[model samples]
Target chain A: MAADLAHLSPLLIVCCVGLGILLLDVFADPKQPKTFIGYVAVVGLLVALAATGWLFATGGVLLTQPYFAVALTLDPFALFGFALILVVAILTTLASVHYLPSQRCEWGEYYSLVVFASLGMMVMVAAADLITMFVGLEIMSVAIYVLAGFKRQSPFAIEAAMKYFFLGAFATGFLLYGLAFVYGATGSTNLNVVAEHFAKNDPGLYGIVIVIMMIVAFGFKIAAVPFHMWTPDVYEGSPSPIAGLMAGGVKTAAFLALARVFLTAFGGADFENLAISWREVFYWLAILTMTVGNILAVVQQNVKRMLAYSSISHAGYILIGIVASRSVDGGAVAGSGLFFYLLAYALSSVGAFAVVSMLGKDGEEDITYGNLAGFAYRHGFAALCMVIFMASLAGIPPTAGFLGKYLVFTDALAATHMNLLPLVLVAVVNSMIGVYYYLKVIVFMYMREPRREFETIRSVPMGIAFGLAALVVVVCGSFPDTTIRWSAKAATGNPSADSAISAASVIDVPAPVATTAK
Target chain B: MEQVIFWILAIGTVASSVAVIVPPMGRNPVHGALSLVVAFFFLAGLYVMLVAHLVAVLQVLIYAGAIVVLFLFVIMLLNIQSEDLGHPRPTISKLIGVIAVGFVSIVLIGFILKDKGMAEPPVGLPSDSTFGTVKTVGNLLYTSYIVPFELTSILLLVAVIGAVIMAKRRL
Candidate 1:
C-alpha cells in the first residue's frame, strides 16, 4: 500500500487537480476571466510533469510491489509519453486562453476538461492491463468528444462531434471484443502474464485474429488510412487548439500504447511462428497510408484539411518505425525513432496550428489558401515562424522532421530478415511527393499579393506558444544527439522485452490442432 | 427435470429476442422496446440455470426494471412520428453493403465452426457452490479489482459532466 501511493503520486496529483478545478469553477466568482483558471490548470500540469520526472528518476511505478505493477507501471516509456502529453496540454492551454474567448466560447470547464484529458493520457501510457487501458482510453475519449463540440452554436462543430463520437464508440467496441478474445485464448489480461503464457503454449490462429482486430481498433485512433475517414472533417470543425491537441498529444499516446502492446505482449516465439505476420500487414498499411494521404492533401484548398491529411501521412512514417522494430537487430533504433519523430511532429504541428488560430479573418476559421495570400508582407516575423514549421514538415535539412525521417529510414534499412529496402525507397518517393504540397503553402504566403489589406488578429499567448514550439523544433533538429539518446533510453527500458526474446528462441513450433486452448 | 426447464427457458429467451427485432414488429420502436423487457426476463431465467444468481438479479433489476422504464419515458418525451422517418431507397451502395455484411457473417461462422475447444468443457468447473453469489462478487470487486472499480466512478463522473455541459439550455 505504501509503495502503491509512491508509484501513483503523479497520476494522483493530476487527478486531484482536475477535480479541484471543477470544484473551484462551481464556487468561484463567475465574472472572473476564465483565462486565469486556464493558467491555474497549466500550473497544475507543470507540477504533475515534475512529479513524473521525479518518479522516473526514482524507478518505475510499483517497483517494490509486483502485484500493483501488473495493473499500472510508470516505466521510462510511460514517463516519456507523460512529458510529451504535458507539453501538448501546456501549449494548448496557452493558446486556448486567447482562442476560447475570441470564439465566444469561454467557459471554465474547458480548462478542466483539458486537465482531465491529460490525466487520461497519463493513465493510458502507464496501464499494464487491458481493463486499465480501456478505462483510461474512455476518460480521454469522452473529454475530447466534449471538447470537439465545445462550440455548440456552429453546425459544423456539432457534426464533427457527433461523427467522431459514433465512430470512436464503434472502434472501442472492436477493441473490447478483441480484448475479450485475447483473454479467452490466454486466460489473462495482464500483458506480462499473457506473454508468459504464449511463451509456454502455442497460441495458434486465435492469436493472429485477435491481433488483427486490435490493430484495426488502434488504427482508427491513430488515424491510419482506410480507418482515417473522419480526420479531415474533425480537424476542420474543432477549434484550432483542440485540433492541435488531438493531432499531437492524442496521436503520441495512441502510438505509445500500440508500440508497448506489440513489443511486449506479442513479441514472443508463439507470435513468430504464426502463419500470418503483423509485419506484412504494417508494410502495406504504411504504403497505402502514405500515398493516399499525400495524394488527397495535394488538392485540398482548406489549410486545416490539408494539415489533417499531412498528419495521416506522418502516421505512415511512424508505422515504418513499428515495422522495423520487429526485426532482431533493429528494435532499439526503430523504437527510439518512433518517439523522436513523435516529439518533432508534435512541436511543429502545435506551432503550425497556433499560427493558424491567429490567421483568422473577422474571427472565423481562415482556412482557404486565398486568405493567406501575402501573409509574409503583413506579419513578417509570424510568417518566418510559419516558414520554419512548413519547411520542417516538408523534411528539409536542419529541422527535426528531417532527422526523424532519416533515423526511421535507416532503422528500416538495418532490418536483416525482411527486405525493407524497397519500402524505404517507396517512402523516399512519397517524401519527395510530399514536398510539392508543403511548398505550395509557402508559395501562397510569400509570393501572392494581399487580397484585402492583410487584415488579421494577433494574440500574445498564441504568439508565445508558437515561439516556444518553434525554438524547440529548431534546437532539437540542430542538437539531435542528446534527444536521440533520451529517446533510446525510454525505448530500451521495458523489462519484459529482453526476457521475451530469449524465451522465443528455445520454444519448439507445435503442429496445428483442431481444438485450441491455452 | 432440470434439463427440461433449461430448454424451456432457452427457447423462450430466443423467441422473445426475435420478437424484439423482427420488423413491422420493430417498426414501432415503442412496441419493440416493450418486447425487450420480456427478453430480459427470459435471459435472467437462463442465467439462473447457469447458477449465476448475481448476474440474473442484475439482469432483472437493471435491464427489466430501470432501463425499460427509461426507454419508454424517452420515447414519450421525444414524440417522434412514423411520418418523420424517411423511407430510404435501396441503391447500388445498399446492395454492396448487404453483400459485404453477408461475407463478414460467413467468415465469422467459419471461425466459430473451426474452433471445437468448448465442446468438451467439464475439466475444471468451479467446485464452490457459492461462486456466483452476491457476496463473492462484492468481495472480488472490492479487493483484487479495486482500482478498476474506483476508476469506473471517474468515468461516470466524466460522462455526467459531458452530458450536463452539452445538454444544458444555456451556459
Candidate 2:
C-alpha cells in the first residue's frame, strides 16, 4: 500500500492542485483579473515537476512493488514524458496570466482547466492499461476543448470548441473500440498480457483491424495529415495561448502515448499479421504528413494558421523516430531521436505561439504578414526572440530543432532491418521546403517597413516565458550532450524493470503451465 | 424453446432499432424516443440470455430510464416539432454511409461464421455461477478496476464545471 501511494504521488499532487485552483477561484472577485490564480497554478506545476525529477533521481524502485492491478507505471520513460509536459504547462500558465484579460475573456476557471488538462496528460502517458489510458485521454482532451473556447464572446472560439469536441468524441470512439478488440483477443486489458498473447499467437486479420483503428485514433490526436483537417481552422480560431498548449503540451503527451503503446504492447514482429505491418503504415503516414503540411503551410496568410500546418509537419518528423526505433539495433539510438525531437519541437513551437498571444487585444486579432511588417523596428526585443524561434523551427544551425532533425535522420540511417534511406531523403526535401516558409516571416519582420502602428501587450510573466524558452533553445542547441543522454535513458529504459512487471503479473500463468507440465 | 425465445428477442431488438431511425415513425422525435426504449428492453433480454445479468439491468436502468428521460427533457426544451425538421433529403454521404454499413455487417458475419475460437469457452474466462453477479462486479470495481473508477469522478467534476462555465449568463 505504501509503495503504491509512493508511486502515485506525482499524479496525486497534480490532481489536488487542479481542485485547489477551483477552490481558490471562489473567493476572488470576478471584476478583478485572476493573475494570482495563474501563480498558484505555476507553483503547483513546479512542485509536481520537482517530484517527477526526484522520482527519476532515486531511480524510482517501482519494479519491485507488488502493484498487481498494473494500471499505471512510474518508469523512467513516464517520468521523462511527465517532466516535458510539466515544463509546457508551467510556461503556458505564465503566459496566460495577462493574455486572458487582454483578450477580454478573463476567468479563473481557465487556470483550473489548464491544471486539469495537465493532470489528464500525466495520467495518460503513465497508464499501463488501455482503460486507464482512455480515461486520461478524456481528462486531457475535455479540458483542452473547453480551453479552446475560453474567449466566449468570440464566435470563432466557440466554433473551434464545437468542431474539436465533436471530432474528438468520434476519434475517442475509435480508440475505445480498438481497446475492446484487444481485450477480446487476449481476455485482458493489461498491456503486458497483450504482449504475451501476441508473442505466441498470430492475431491475423483481427490484428490488422486493431492496428488501423489505433492509427486513426492516435493520428487524429496528433493531427497527422488527412486527419489534420481540423488543425488549421481550430488553431486560427482559438485563443493563442490555448493554441500553444494544444500544439506544445497536448502533442507531446499524445505522441509519447502513441510510442508507449506501439513499443510496449505491440512490440513483437509477429504482429505483422497477414495483411501489412504497422511500420509500413506509419512510414507512409510520415511522408504524407510532412509533405502536405509544408505545402499547405506555404499558402496560409494567417500566422496562427501557418504554425498549425508547421505543427503537422513537425508530427511527421517525429514519426520518423518511431519507425526507426522499430528496427532491431535501433533501440536506444532511434528512441532518443524520437524523444529529443519532441523536446525541441515542444519548446520552440510553444515559444513561437507565446509571441502571437501578445499581439491580440479586445477579442480582435489579425497576424497577417502585412500586419507584421516592420515588427522589428516596433518591438525589437520580441522580434529578436521571434527570430530565434523561427530559426529553430526552420531547423537552422545554433538551435535545438536543427540538432533534433540531425539526430532523427542519422538514427534512421543507422538502422538496418528496413531501408529507411529513401524515407530520410524525402524528409530532407521536406525540410528544405520548410526553410522557405519559415524564413518568409523573418524577412517580413526585418526588411519590410512598418505597414501599420502596433503595440504588443507586455507583462513580466510573459517576458519571463519568452526569455526562458529562448534560453533553453540556445543552450540545448550548443551543449546537446546532457539532454541527449537523458532522453536516451527514457527511450530504451532499463530492461530489468520490464522483466519485473512481467514477473509480478504472470503469477497466475505459471500455474496453468505447471498443470500442462503434468 | 430457448432457441425460439432467442430469435424473438433478437428480431424484436433489431426491428425496434430500425424503427427508431427509419422513416414513418422516425420523423417524429417523440416516437423515436419511445422506440428506443423498446429496443433497449429487447437488448436487455438478449444480455440476460447471455448470462450478463448485471449489464442487462444497467442497460435498462441507465439507457431506458435516465438517458432517455434526459433526451426527452432536451426535446421538450427545444419545443421542436416535425415541421421544424424540414424535409429529409438524400445526400451523397448518406448513400455512402449505408453502403459502408452493409459491407461491414456482411464481413463481420463472415468472420463470425469462420471463427474457430467460438466453439469452446475462452481459456481465460471464469465460467462459474459467480460471474457477472452484482457482488462480483462491485468487488472488481473496488479492487482490480479501482483506478479507472476513481478517475471517472474527476472526469465528471471537470465536465460539470465546464458545462456551468459555458452556459452561465455572465462570467
Candidate 3:
C-alpha cells in the first residue's frame, strides 16, 4: 500500500497544486494580476518532475512494488512521458504569464486550470487500464477546451472552444466504442489481460474495427490527415500560449497514450499476424500525413496555421519511429526514437509558438509575414531565438530536432521486420519541403521591411520561456548520447520492446513470452 | 416463469420503443418522451431478469427519472409545434449514407458467414448473483477502481468550472 502511494506522488502533487491555487485565489485581490498563481504552478510542476526523475533513478515507481500495477503504470516509459509533459506545461505557464495580463484575462482560474490539465496528462500517460486512460484523456481535454477560450471576449476563442469540444467529444465516442468492442472480444478492460487474450486467440474482424476506431480517435489528437481538419482553425483561434500547449503538451500526452495502448495490447510475438495490417495502415497514414501536411503548410501565410500543419508533418515522422519500433524480428533495434523525438519536437513547437505569441499585440494576433517583417531589427535576441527554434524544427544540425529526426529515420532504416525504407524516403522529401516554409519566417524577420507599424510584447517571462527552450534544443542536439540511452531504456515498457532492448544489451534476455502473459 | 416474464418485458420494450418514432406518439414530442420512459422501464425490467440489478436501477433512475424528464423540459421550453418540423427528405448525401451502410452490412454478413462461431449473439447466460449487486458495485468503486473514480471527480470539476468560466459574465 505504501509503495503504491509512492507511485502516485507525481499526480497527487499536481492535483494538490491545482486545488491549492483555486483555494488561494479566493484571497487574492481581483484588481491585481494573477501571475503569482502561474509561478506557483511552475514550482509545483518542477517538484513533480524532480520526483519523477528520482523515481526513475531509484529502480522505478516504488522499488518494493512489482513492475506492473492494476490501474496505473509508473514505469520508466511513463516517467519519461511525465518529464516531457511537465516541461511543456512549465513552459506554457511561463509563456502565458505575461500574455494573460496583456490580454486582460489574467484570472487565477487560468493558472489552476493549466495545472489540472497537466495532472490529467500525468494520469493519461500512467494509465494501465483502458478505462483509466479514457477518463484521464477527458480530464485533459476539458481543461484545454476551457484554456483554448480563456479569452472569452474574443469570438474566435469561443469558436475554438466549441469546435474542439464537439470534435473531441466525437473522437472520445469513437474511443468508447472501441473500448466496448475490445471488452466484448476479450471480456476485460485491463491491458495485460487484453494482451494475453489477443495473444492466445485470433482477434478476427472485431479486432480490425477496434484497431481502426482507436486509430481514428488517436489520429485526431495527434493531428494526422483525414482527421486533421480541426487543427488549423483551433490553433489560429486559440490564445497563442494555449495554442502552444495544444501543440506541445496535449499532443505529447495523446501520442504517449496511443503508443502505450497499441504497443502493449496489440504488439507482440504471438500477435504478429494482427500487427501487420495496422502497421500497413500506419505506413500509408504516415505518407499521407507528411505529404499533405507539408504541401498545405507551404501556402499558409499565417505563422500559427503553418506551424499547425508542420506539427502534423512532424507527427508523421514520429509515426515512422512507432512503425519501426513495433515489430520484433530479433533485430538489433535498440529503441523507438519516440521519446527523444517527442521531447525535441514538443520543446521546439512550444518555443516557436511562444515566439509567435509575442507578436500578438493588444490581444489581437497579427502573425502574418507583414507583421513579422523587421522583427530582427527591432528585437535581435528574440529573432535569434526564433531562428534557432525554426532551424531545429526544419531539422538542421546543432539542434535537438535534427537529432530527433536522425534517430527516427535511422530506426526506420534499421528495422528488419517490414520495409520501412520508402516511408523514410518520403519523410526525407517532406522534411525538405518543410524547410522552405520554416525559412520563410526567417526571411521575413531579417530581410523584409515592416509593411505597417506594429509592436510586439517583449515581456521578460516570454523571453525566459523561449530562451530556456532554445538552450535545451541546442544542448540536447549536441549531447545526444545520454538521452538516446535513457529513451532506449524507457522503450522497455512493452514486452516486445523489452526483448528488443535486451537483445542489444550485454545482459541475458528474458523470455519475451513469459512476461507477455502478465 | 422467468422465460414468460422475459418475453413480456422484451415485447413491451420493443413496442414502446417503436411507438416513440411512429404515428400519434411521434407526432407529439411530449407523447414521444412518455413512450421513451415506458421503453426505459421495460429495458430495466429486462436488465433485472439478467441479474444486473444495479444496471436496472440505473436504467430507471438515469434514463427514466432524469433523462426523460430533461427531454420533457427541453420540449416544453422550446414549445416547438409538430407542424414546424420539416418532412423527411431523401437527399444525395442520405442516399450515399444508405449505400455505405448497406455495403458495411453486407461485409459484416460475409464475415459472420465465414466465422460460424460469431454468428449468434450470446443471450442471458448465467452470471454471479452478487455480480451487479449495489454493495458489490460500491465495493468495486472504492476498492479496485478507486483511482479512476477519484479522477472522474476531477474531470467533472473541470467541466463544471469550465461551464462557469465560459458562462459567467465576467472573470
Candidate 4:
C-alpha cells in the first residue's frame, strides 16, 4: 500500500543505498579512485537524512498504519532514532574521507560497509521484535568487526578484532538464550505480546530470571561494568573514524533499543510489583560503570584509551537517564533528557575523534599524552575545537554536554522524590571523577611541552565536517529550547497533554492480556 | 531409556568440553580438535533429547563432521605440533580469564536460583507425530521462515567468499 511504502521510505532508502554502493564497487573499474565511493556513500547518507526530515514533516506515519502487525511499531520513537542515525552516518562518512587516505588504506568496500552498518543500526533502534533486533545487532557487529581489523597487518588490530568477535558472539549467545527464556514465559517474541502476557500471568520466578538475563544481554551491548573489557582495546586498535562510529553511533543505537525494550516492553505495574525490579539492576550498573570507567581512564597515558574509558563512563551516565525514565514520577522529562544527551555526546565525541584522525601520519600515531603537548601552538583551530570537545565532555558550562548533564541531573532529582536518591548521588560522584581525565587532555594540549615536531594535515572536507559538529555543539548549547521541545514531544507518547498523563499511567501499569490468536 | 541416554551424553559432553579447554601436558592440536568433535556429538545427543531432531542431526553433521574436520585441516596445514603450544600467557591474562569464568558461573547460578520454583516439564514430546521430524522441519523452514532461511544461504555464500579472500595470496 502507498501508506506502508511511505512510512518505510527512510529504511528502504538506506538499504537501497547499501546495495547501490555494493553494485558500484563491483561494476566500477578496479583502478577507479576510492574517494568516488566515499562521495557516493556520503551523498546517499545526506539524501537519507533529507528524506527522514521530509517524513517527519509530511508523512504523518504513512497513512497511520502500523507496519509488521504490531510486532514492529513504526512510530515517532523510531523516527527519532532514524534521524539520529542519519546524522551520525553523515558525520562519520565525512570524517572517513580524510582518515582512510591518511592511513593509505582507502578501500571502496569501506564506504559500503559503513553504509551497511548504518542501515543495521537503523534496524536495531527501530526493531519491535526480538528476532529482528538480534539480526540487526549482528549485522552492525559483523561489519564493525571487519572494520576494526581493517589494518590487517597490525597485530594490535588483529588482536582487537579477535577479542571483539569472541566477546560479541558470546554476548549474542546470552541475548538469544534470554530470548528463549522470555519465549518460554510468554509464548511469543513480540514485545507487546510479551508485555501483555506478563500483565495477566503471575510469571512468578520465571519473570525474575528472564529479566536478569535480558539485562545482562543489554548490559553487555552498552558496555556496562563487568562487560566492558572489549571496548578499550577495540577503540584503541581501530581506525579513529571507526572508533568514532562505534562510540557515538553504535552506542546510541544500542541504548535506544535498550530503552525501547526495557521501558516500553518489560516495564509497568505488573513487572514492577513482582519480586524482581529492573530499576535496582540499572541502579547498581550505572553506579559501578561510571565509577570504574572514570577511575580507569585517569590512569591511562594513551589518549585513545582514555577516550575509550570516557565513553564507558558516558554509557553509565546515559543509563541513569534510562533508569530515571522508568521511575514512577519521572516520565517524558527523563526520556527527553536521554535523547538530548545522546545527541550532545555523539556530536562532541565524533568531533574529538575527527581531530585524532587528522593527527595520524601513514595510519600510525603513538598519541600519548606527551605526544599531544604544544599541539595548540601548531594547529590553533583544531586544538580549540578539541578543547571545546573535551570541555563539553567534562560537562563544563556553555556547551551542549553541560546542558545534557543538567537534564539528566534534573531527571535523577525527580526520581529521588520516589526514593532513588542513592542513584543520583552515585551519578554526581561519577561526574566528579570524569572531570579528572577530560581535563587531563586539556592539560596535555595546552600546558605540557611537545616532545617532537608537530605537523598538521589540512583536509578541507574533514575540517568542514568537524567545524559543523563544533558549531552544533555551541548552537545547541546556546539555544537548547527547540531540540529539547521536540524530544519532549516525542517522549510524550500522546499528542494531547491530558492524554499524555493518562497514557503514561496506562503504560506504568502493564496492559491486560489480550490474545492475538483472534 | 531417554534419561539414561541423556545422562551418558551429558557426562561425555562435559568431560570433552573440559578437555578441549585444559591442555594436558603435551596435548596435540589434533587431540584438542578430536575432543571438540566428541563434545559436538554429545551436544547433538542432548538436542535429540530436547526433541529438536533436525537440529540434532545438523549439529552432528555441521559441527562434528564439517567444522572439526576444518580445524584438523588447519592444524595440519600449519604443521602445529604438541610441543608447539607456547608458554602460558602472563599472570594478569590468566587472572582475567579466571575472573570472567567466575563471573559467568555466578550469574548462571543466580539465574538458576531465581527460576528454581518455575521449572516445568519440557514441551514438544519426542514423537514423530508430535514434534518436528526432518521432513516437517524442512517444510516449516521453506514455508514460515522462508525469508530467513534464504538469507542464511546468502550468509553462507558471503562466508565462502570471505574465506577465499582471506586465504588468497594476492588480490
Candidate 5:
C-alpha cells in the first residue's frame, strides 16, 4: 500500500494541482492577471517532474510495486515518457501565458485543462491495461478538444473543435472495440496477461481483428497516413500554443502508448506468425505515412498546416523505430531511439509554434508563408530560433533532430531479422523531401523582401519558453550520450521483464493452464 | 415463457431503433429523440432478460431519462425549421458509405455468431447468478476497477467544464 501510494503520488499531485487551479480561478481576484494561474500550473508540473526524477533515482522501489491493478507502472520507460510529456506541458503552459491573454481567452480552465491533459498523458504512458489506457486517451482528447477551440468567437476554432471531437470519439470507439476483442481473446485486459496468453497460444482470428482496429485507432491519434485527414484542419484552426501542445505532447503520449502496446504485448520474435507480425503492418505504414505527409506538407501554403503534415511525417519516423524493434537484438536500441526522437521532435515543435504564436497580435494570427516574409529583419532573435528549429526539423547536423534520425535509421539497419533497409532508404528520401518545406519557411523568414512590418505580441513568458526549448534542443544535440543511455535503459527493461514473467509464472500455472490458459 | 418475453422486447427494441433513424421520423427531431428513448427502454428490458439488473437500471436512469431529456432540450432549443433540416440527399458518396458500413456490420455479426471452439460458459461467473447484481458490480467497480472509476469522475468534470465553456452566453 505504501509503495502504491508512493508510485501514484505524481498522478495524484497533478490532479490535485489541476483541481486547485480550478478553485483558485474561481476565487482569485478578477483584476489579477490570468497568467498567475499559468505560473501555478508550471510550478505544479515542475514538482511532478521532480517526483518522477525522485522515483527514477529510487529505482526499483516504485518500479516493483504491485500497482498494476490501477493500470499504471512506475517503470523507467513510463518515467522517461512522463518526463518528456512534462517538458511539453511546462513549455505549453509558458507559451499559453503569453498567448491566451493576447486572444482575450485566458480563462482559468485553460491552464487547468492543460494540466489535466498532461495528467492524462501521464496516465497513458503509465497504463498497463487497455481500459486504463482508453480512459487516459479520452481524458487527453477531451481536454484538447476544448483547448483547440479556446478562441470561442472564431468560427474556425469552433469547427475544429466539433470536427476533432466527433472524429476522436469515432476513433475511441475503434480503440475500445479493439480492446474488447483483445480482452475476449486473452480473457484479460492486462498487457502482461495478453503477452502471457499469446506465448502459450496462437493468436487466432481475433488477434488480427484486434491489431487492425488498434492500428486504426492509434493511427488516428498519431495522425498516420490515411488516418490523418483531421490533422491539417484541426491544427490550422486551433490556437497556435494548443496546436503545439497537440503536436508535441499528445503525439509523444500516444506513440509511447503505442510502443508499450505493440512492443510489450504483441512484439514477439514471431515473424512466421504473419497474422500478428505488426512489424510488417508498421513497415508499410511508415513508408506511406512519411511519403504522404511530406508530399502534402510541401504543397501547403499555411505554416500551421505545414507543421501538421510535418508531425505526421514525424510519426512515420517513429514507426521506423517500432519496426526495427521487432528484431530480437535491436528491440532496446530501436525502442530507446523512438523515445529520444520524440523528445527531440517535441522541443523543436514547441519552439517553432512559440515563434508562430509570437507573430500574432491583437487577435490577428499570421498563418501563411507570406506572413513570414523577411521576419529575420523584424525579429532577429525569433527568426534565428526559427532557423534553428527548421534546421533541426530538416535533420541538420549538431541538432537533436539529426541525431534522432541518425539513431533510428541506424537502429533500423542493425535489425537482422527484419529487412528494413528498403524502408530506411525510403525514409531518407522522404526526409529529403521534408527538407524542402522546412527550408521554404526559413527562406521566407530570411531571404524574401520585407512585407508589412510584422507586428507581434512580445511577452516574457513566451520568450522564456522559446529560449528553453532552443537551449534543450542544442544541448541535447551536442551531448546525446546521457539521453541515449536513459532511453535505452527504459527500452531494454521490457524484454528482461517479459522473460521474468514466464519464469515466475511457471509454478503458478498448474490448474488454470487447462482452462483459462487457452 | 422467457423466450416469449425476450422476443417481444427484442422486436420492440429493433422497431424503435429503426424509427429513430428512418427518414420521416428524423424529419421532426423530437420524434426521433422520443423514439430513441423508446429504444433505450426496450434495450433495458433486454438487459433485464440477461440478468444484468444493474445495467438495466442504468440504461433506464442514464440513457432513457437523462440522455433523452437532454436530447429533447437541445432539439427544442435549436428550434430548427423543417426546411432548415433539409430533405435527404441521395448522393453516391452517402450510398457508398451506407453500403460499406452495412457490409462491415454483416462481417462483424458473422464473426460474433461463428463458433470458435467455445462450448462452455466463462469460468468466473458466481454460481449463485448474482454476478451482475448491483452489490457485486459496485464491489468490483470500487475495488479492482477503481482507477477507471475515479478517472470517469474526472472525465465528467472535464466534460462539464467544456460544455459550460462552449455553451455559456459569455466567456
Candidate 6:
C-alpha cells in the first residue's frame, strides 16, 4: 500500500495542484495581477520531478507490483516516462508565465489544465492495459482540445479546436475499432496475454488487420503523413505555450507509449507468425513522414507553422527508431535512440517555442521570417538562445539534436545490415532536407534586421526557465552518454523484474520435435 | 427471430448513418439531429443483440432522447439557416474525402477477402445469464472502472458549466 502511494505521489501532487489553482482562482481578482499560478505549477512539477528522482534512486523499492493489476504497471519504464513528462511540464509552465499574460487570457484554468494534462500523460505512459491507455489518451486529449481553443473569441482558435476535435474524434474511433478487433482476435486486452496468444497461435489475416488498425491509430497520434493535416493549423492557432506543450509533452508521451506497445507487446519471433510484418509499414511511414514534413516546413513563412511542420518531421525520425527496434537484432539500440531523440527534440522544440512565445506582444504577433529581422540586436539573450535551439534542431555538432540524430542513424545503419537498406537511405536524405528549415529559423533570427520596434515583455522567471532549458540542450548534447545509457536501460523491459509475467513466458516455443516415428 | 431483428437493426443503422451525412442544399439542423436519433436507436438495437440490454437502453435515453433534444434546442436558439452553412468546402477537400473513403473501402474489402478463420464463440455460456447485460456492466463500472466512470460524470459537469459560460450573455 505504501509502495503504491509512493508510485502515485507525482500524479496525486499534480491533481492537488490543479484543484488548488482552481480554488485560488475563486478568490483572486480577474484582472491579471501578475498572478503566481505559473510559479505554483512549476513548483508542483518540480516536486513531481524530485519524487521521480527519489523513486528512481530507491530503484526497486517504490516499484509497486502492478498498481491496478492488469491495468497499470508502476515500473522503471513508467518512472522514466514520468520524469520526461515532468521536465516538459516544468518548461511549459515557465513559458506560460510570460506567454499567457501577453495573450490577455491569463486564467487559473490554464495552470490547472497543464497539471491535469501532465497527470494524464503520466498515466498514458504507465498504462499496462489497452483500456487504461485509452482512458489516459482521452483525458490528455480532452484537456488539450480545451487548451487549444482557450481563446474563445478568436476565429483561428475556434477553427483550431474544431479541426483538432474532428480529427481527434476520428482517430479515437479508429483506435477503438482496432481495440475491438484485437479483443475479437485474442479475447483479452492485456498486453502480456496478447503476446502469449501471438506466441501460441499462427496469427493469419486477423492479426495483420488488427496490427494495421493500431498502426493507423498511432500514426494519427504521432502526426505521420496523410494523417497529419491538423498539425499546422492547430499549432498555428493555439497559444504558443500550449503549442510548446503539445509539441514537447504530448508527443514525447505518445512516442513512449507507442514504443512500449510495439516493442514489448508486439515484437520478436511471436510476431513473425502474423502474415504481415510491422517493419514494412513503419519503414514506409518513416520515410514518408520525414520527407513530407521537412518539405512542407520549408515553405512555411509563419514561424509557428514552420515549427509545427518541423515537429512532424521529427516524428518521422522517431518512427525510424521504432522501425529499427522491430528489426531482428536492433531492438535495444533503436529503442534507446528513440528515447534520447525524443528528449532532445522535446527540449529543443520547447525552448524554440518559448522564444516564440516571448516574441509575441498583445496576443497577435505575426512571427514571419521577415518580421524577425534584426532580432539579435534587439533581444540579444533570446536571440542567442533561439540560435542554440535552432542549431540543436538542425542537428548541428555539439548540440543535443546532433547526438540524437547520431544515435538514430546508427540504429538505422544497424537495421540496414538486416536488409532495411532502402529505409536507411531515405532517412539519411530526409535528415539533410530537415536541416534547411531548422537553419532557416537561425538565418531569420541572426541575418535579418528588425524592421519595426519589437516590444518585449520581460518576465524574470520565464527568462530563467529558458536559460535552464538552453543549458540542458547544450549539456545533454555534449555529454550524451548518461541519458543514452539510462534510455537504453529503460527501453529494455526488465523481463526478470517482479511482475505478473516472467521473461520465460515471452520466449518462443520451439517447434514440437519432429515425429519421425509417425 | 433474433437474426431477423439483427438484420432489421443493421439496416436501420446503415440507413440512418447515410441520412446523417447526406442532406442536399441547406438541410435543417433538426433534420441532421433526427438522423442522429435514428442512428442511436439502431446502435441500441445492436447493444441488445450483444446482450448489453442496459447499455442499449441508456444509449437511446441519453443519445437519442436527451442529446438529440439538446441539439434541436441549440439549433433553434442559434437560428442557423441553410445558407449559414458557412463556407463551401474546396474541390480538393472533396476529392481527398473521396480518396479516403475509397482507400477505406479497399482495405475493408481486402480484409473480407483474406478469409482469416472465424472466432469460435465461448461454449456453455448460458444465453439467459445476462452476463453482458446491464447489471453486470453496471457492477463492473462501479467496481473496476469506477475512477473513469466518476471522472466522466465530472467531465459532463464541467462541460455543462463550460457551455453555460460560453453561451450566456452575462456570467
lDDT of 4 by residue, A108-149 (tens): 667767877787788777665676677677767777777777
Say which prediction, candidate 1 or candidate 5, comes out ahead on TM-score. 5
Query: Over the stretch A201-249, how does candidate 1's per-residue lDDT look in tens digits?
Result: 7776578667878888889988999999899999898888888888888
TM-score of chain B of each: 0.79, 0.87, 0.72, 0.86, 0.89, 0.83
For candidate 4, give the docking quality class from DockQ. Answer: incorrect
Each candidate's lDDT (Cα)? Answer: 0.79, 0.82, 0.82, 0.74, 0.82, 0.75
TM-score of each: 0.91, 0.93, 0.88, 0.87, 0.94, 0.91
Candidate 5 Cα errors over 4 Å, as ranges: A60-70, A269-276, A327-334, A494-518, B1-8, B118-127
First chain of model 5: TM-score? 0.94
Docking class of 2: acceptable
Q: Candidate 3: where are CA atoms >4 Å away?
A: A62-68, A327-334, A493-518, B1-46, B63-115, B118-128
Look at candidate 1 and tell me the lDDT of residue A153: 71
For every prediction, compared with the true complex, DockQ reads 0.41, 0.40, 0.38, 0.17, 0.42, 0.25
Residue pairs with clashing backbones, model 5: none
Q: Write the per-residue lDDT of candidate 5 for residues A1-518, one digit (tens) a residue.
A: 76667777788889999999999999988877888999999999999999988876555233343334336666777888888889889999998897887887878999899988998998998887778888888889999999998898888888899899999999898898889888777766767667667666767556667888899999999999889999999998899998999999999999989988887677654323855477888899999999999999999999999999999998899899888875243235245778788889988998899889998777767579998999898888888888888888889978999999998998889888678899999999999999999999999998999878778878888888888988888888899999888778677654335433532242132222222212
The sequence of per-residue lDDT tens digits that candidate 3 reaches over residues B1-171 is 977998899999989998897645447878999999999999999998777899999999999999899899989988999888767677998899679769966875675466655555444545554668999888767755677899999999888889889988866
Candidate 6 lDDT at B64 equals 87
Q: Write the per-residue lDDT of candidate 3 for residues A235-256, one digit (tens) a residue.
A: 9999888888999899899888
**Share of the reference A-B contacts seen in candidate 1:** 0.40
Error of 2 at A297 (Å): 1.0
CA-RMSD of model 6: 4.4
The clash numbers for all candidates, in the given order, read 0, 0, 0, 0, 0, 5
Give candidate 1's whole-model lDDT.
0.79
